[model samples]
Target chain A: MDKEKYAKLEQKISPKPPLLKNVIKAFLVGGTICLIAQFIALFYMTFFNFTERTASNPTVATMIFISMLLTGFGVYKKIGQVGGAGGAVPITGFGNAVVSAAIEHKSEGFVLGVGSNIFKLAGSVIVFGVFSAFLVALVKTILVKMGVVSW
Target chain B: MFSIYITSFIVGGLICVIGQLLFDVAKLTPAHTLCILVVTGSVLDGLGLYEPLIDFAGTGATIPITSFGNALTHGALAEAEKHGLIGVLTGMFEVTSSGISAAILFGFIASFIFKPKGSV
Candidate 1:
């Protein structure tokens, strides 16, 4: 049996993400958010008993907590304006989804408003997260079955 | 240590730059762009490529919303390997449970404390 070339396989495996300079503001904002998150992760590791792997969960929690406050204060919207996707692409964006939707739908009452709409923006992300995982796993499982790869 | 910060910033920034381009040039909404990035991240991780990127850039790789997809896929694949096909379904949310749970809990609480200020 013949195997594919490694370079060709690399192309098949990973799509090249864009590296072109588009908006400097987005770059700065997004990068800054991640950098801050790195610090938070470090803090968890330093002060707590979290390892590198475990620290991510707490770090993400803290960032979302920060974003929830910022969104309530109307500050996150400003950051979204300045940063565009930068503002919306981090875990903070998930916070924005819940906070913004809850605020926007408050007049509709609590059960219908906050409870239902809290996940309005975020629900799609979750759907895609689960759906994509299933699809990719299916493919990987098939590949492993074919003996082309291991798990 | 210093290098970790630099790479994290640059790679993370680069990802956001791509997102900006999707908005400006591709004309996709933020939702669509995020969806696309998530799929890309999952596909890449399935191919065994995203781990290297994560290894190199640290939080730069993990902090993006795309990492959610990566984590989900990683969990699913790991579970599939360990416990067979059924694990694929079960393990998908294993690692990503925290981010979504935190967002929900904090968003609910914060909404009570702070009413929405209208866009004045």
Candidate 2:
């Protein structure tokens, strides 16, 4: 029965590609995200004495925040609609993921319902990311100490 | 500079191509695929394999799910280092709150005005 179900499912094709409107919306929304990052980079460079090279980190940080805000307000869904993954795939889009998930689950309550679970998807991603990077950084630090690598 | 640009363009395009193939050819939802990509990117980055790819490809590597993971990790670490235990939560938000707020605010406004239609 499972094999037959799998076979039947595999044979189906979506009637069309994701809608053109969605693609364009994604393009515009995604492009807007990039533009915001550029602005943040420029701002850091101009006001904080950060070099062009150093400003990228802050820019990425800013983009994530903006996407989070957008997700909360619900504009990203529109963008996601028009943009599909185009709108939903960027760093800001990741923000949308966390916030939207929280919003979806918000009816549960505040502490566990909204506050703790608000950033569920994003939180997991961050946890894994930080832990993994720590391991990498540790290896690099050890290697550098041993003169096997240089920063 | 020209060579760098060319390399980034090609690599970014390739990354998108693979992502697209995963979307169109494979049987995964976009979010699921993105989650997988982000995790994969983070692991590769953790192994230090992704850094070189990032140096070479710039936007290609930076534009995907992995980049998101990298940012989260970087933010959390920075926060934790500065404030100890409390910094973990504060760090994540402090690092990302602005952009996240911006995204949510604008997304909310847009949704309110435009009423985007789709299944979540």
Candidate 3:
């Protein structure tokens, strides 16, 4: 069969993705995760010396820790299946990435296996995050020097 | 105070929705989606917009992976403002060091105690 004919046949037979439903699920899961994080941030603000601005640091760390537990227990995968990007888009997802990679490579011993593979998914995040952070800061520094904008 | 909760939920959810669309419509992998969002966050912060979003949405703005970029850039810029050139390198991780450190420490513990289960 020609490529166009095969493409048409494939399109006709393929099951449609439930885009709307998936989007709603993602929003709910993602929003709920943020709501829980909100409370965590508030807890830090109320009980500690942290202000609203300063509270996110602790809040993110706490969320990651919780995700570590969830990932370790394998519960996070269920959440990921249901929540899709909702589960994958938050700080918890970053923690899950680290833990899951570590768990996957546990057989090769700690040094060659877990240590090297621990960052397989998340290493890009840190590298690009820091690199872009440097670039942004560089631009802002030049802007400040020229009085184009305040820091 | 009450409005903050609503804003956080809605805004945070919307960010995820955008990611969902990227997956379904754009067909990007999770890693690519995350990298794109992080860079978008850095661009927004460099444009001086993300802080206002944080002011508007509270945890709504901070909880998403995008905020990781925002925090890192904010730290670098803050240091750059004070110490000029070298400050950027020093401050790149000032705010996020705790989060990364916690992940590393917990990762070690998790490896020691936890076994990977059957595939989900």
Candidate 4:
């Protein structure tokens, strides 16, 4: 550990998660999430007559929704104990963030407290990402219009 | 195809190994290391140098947080073309919504039960 960097990082508020467990959790949770998604897709294909390709998207959406529900119910916490970032970095993790924030502040009243801040940190990140992409796209369009480069 | 899969697995493993070395042996912090790898990958990709690596590795490149940033950039750029200045937000969220949704759902669940033991 770099003393200087450690000192600096230590000042920041974050969990001191166990490395091995988190890594294992990430692998297991991430894989399991993917496996569950595959199962959903297979089920859709088998019962509903959806094509494999067609089944993929709805399966993903369903997975995210289920993940959100889990996060709302606090079951993901148990998964996180084993999966860490493997669980946290996936789409399900994002759902957890918004819902959890809402749950945390639900006492403030649904609209102002829970609903308003539901996106909170994750919202900002998405917003920033979207905004920045728009700017870049605009520039590219302007350049393209001016015959600067071909798409 | 089999060779490609094997190569991807190896290269992806190597990236993790390098990440581990950086975390365990180097003086650099995890965020810093992650940042460096992602930025390096992005810059190389922007310069058209990383495509071959991506082709060979697939998820090796996409699994990293930096790839997430690249996806955001690509999404924003694509949307901005359609929606003018507003595309930034539109493009980014549209492309990444699935991932974001997933993250939020899981994060929410974890937070409720584990309560994150620490503060932001």
Candidate 5:
């Protein structure tokens, strides 16, 4: 068989993922996480003197905390496997990344292993997060100073 | 209130769908996608765009990593206003300290207790 024919033959035999099922699963799981977060924020707003805007910080912190606990118990990995991007695209995934790295590297010893490698995945997140924020802030400040756009 | 909930759900779900598309079509790694999201959030927040999104979508907008970046920038800018140049140094991390510290602390404890399921 020619190369193209051989490739097509191989493609025909390969198992296809259930794309629709996975999308539905992802949508449900992701929406569930956001729903929980929203509830938490509402709780804070109702009981604590926080407005909708102010409640976000505590809501995110609580979600990350819950994710870390789940990661510790080895539950999050299962979630990631089943939920795929649904499990990961939220802040919980960020928690999983940090804790999983630390767990993976724990055998190498404390400071160098757990400490250093803990941020291996998340470090990029923080670095880029801060850098991007700085750049945008700088541009905003310049534009405001020059009166190019009034804020 | 009901409309807010519906919008939040749709927006949050859509963001995840976009992430899924990136993973499937673009084959971007999770880390790369996350970084991109954070950067996008920061840029939008800095441009004063994300605030409106937050107003419209609430937790739908905030639960994503982009909101974290948005909070960092807003915190730093607020601090810079109060403390001048010194605020720039202390502001960003201060805003995010709770989340960061919690992750580190919980991660450290979890690592100490849990053994790897597979070869590290």
Candidate 6:
């Protein structure tokens, strides 16, 4: 078949995604994840000496830990399948990515497989996160010294 | 308190919806999207723009990966104020150490206990 005909045929066969439904699912799932994190933060604030800002650190850590556990049990994959970006926009998504990679490559042995491959998905996040922060700080420092803008 | 929950829910939900649109319409890879968000977050935080959003939305802003980048920048800047040049070296990771360490540690343990479904 000609290229145009082949493209039309492929389009006919492929299933269209339910875009609106998927968006609602993602919205609900993502909102729920944030709600859980907020609850944890509030718990820390009320029960401990942590203020709202300080409570966030532990809240994030706890979310990551819980997501990692869920990823191990393979529940997170299901959540990802259903939630799409909803499953990925949170820090829990980062946890799921890292743990899933490590789990997927576990049989190649610990050091090379789990250790090296674990960061495959999330390494870029860490690298760019740190790099961008450094660049911004460098600029801020220079601008402050130059008296162009003062914090 | 209730307003905080509603604001957080709506903001967080909107961010996720935007991310989904990027994935579906723009065809950006998740990794690329993640990198973009983190960088954008850091830049906004540096420019003093993100703090206001965080103030308005609370965990809605803080729960996203962007906020993690914002937190890193905030920590680095605070450290730089106290320690000067040396802070640039130590600040980013120092502030994020807890989250990173937890991710790595939990990931390792999970890997140890669970086996892959099949060899690729």
- Kindly report which residue stretches of model 4 are placed more than 4 angstroms away from their true locations once superposed: A1-21, A42-57, A139-150, B1-120
* Candidate 5 lDDT over residue span A1-151, tens digit each: 8999999999899876567766777777777788788889889999999999778878877898899778877788888877777788788888889989999899899898999999998888899989887777666666666778755
Candidate 5 lDDT by residue in tens digits, B1-120: 857777777777777777777676677898888888888888887788888998998888888777778877877666666775456556777667767887788889878788767422
DockQ score for model 1, please?
A: 0.50
Computed on alpha carbons, the lDDT of every model, listed in order, comes to 0.86, 0.55, 0.89, 0.54, 0.79, 0.84
Q: How many backbone clashes does candidate 1 have?
A: 0
Candidate 1 lDDT over residue span A1-151, tens digit each = 2355776887688755343434788899999999999999889999999997788889889999999989999999999988888888888987898888887777787789888999898888888988998999988998898999986
Candidate 6 lDDT over residue span B1-120, tens digit each: 678788888888887887777777677888887888888889998999988987777788888888878878877887777787567657877666767888898899989788655321
Query: Which runs of model 1 end up more than 4 angstroms from their true locations?
Result: A1-22
List the candidate 6 regions with Cα displacement exceeding 4 Å. Answer: A1-13, B117-120
The full ranking of all candidates by DockQ, starting with the best, is 3, 6, 5, 1, 2, 4
DockQ of each: 0.50, 0.20, 0.80, 0.18, 0.58, 0.65
Of 1 and 5, the candidate ranking higher by DockQ: 5
Task: Give the range where candidate 6 chain A is weakest over 10 consecutive residues by summed lDDT.
Answer: A138-147
Error of 2 at A62 (Å): 3.0
lDDT of 3 at A110: 93
**DockQ metric, candidate 6:** 0.65
* The candidate that achieves the highest lDDT relative to the unseen native structure: 3
Evaluating just chain A, the predictions reach TM-scores of 0.83, 0.68, 0.92, 0.69, 0.84, 0.89
Model 2 Cα lDDT, one tens digit per residue, B17-55: 444545655756765667666666655644557667756
For residues A58-99, write the lDDT of model 3, one tens digit per residue: 898899889989999999999999988899888888899998
Q: Which of the two, 3 or 5, has more DockQ? A: 3
Best by DockQ: 3
lDDT of 1 at A68: 90
Kindly give the stretch of ten consecutive residues in candidate 3 chain A with the minimal lDDT sum.
Answer: A122-131
**TM-score, per-candidate, Cα-based:** 0.90, 0.61, 0.95, 0.56, 0.87, 0.91
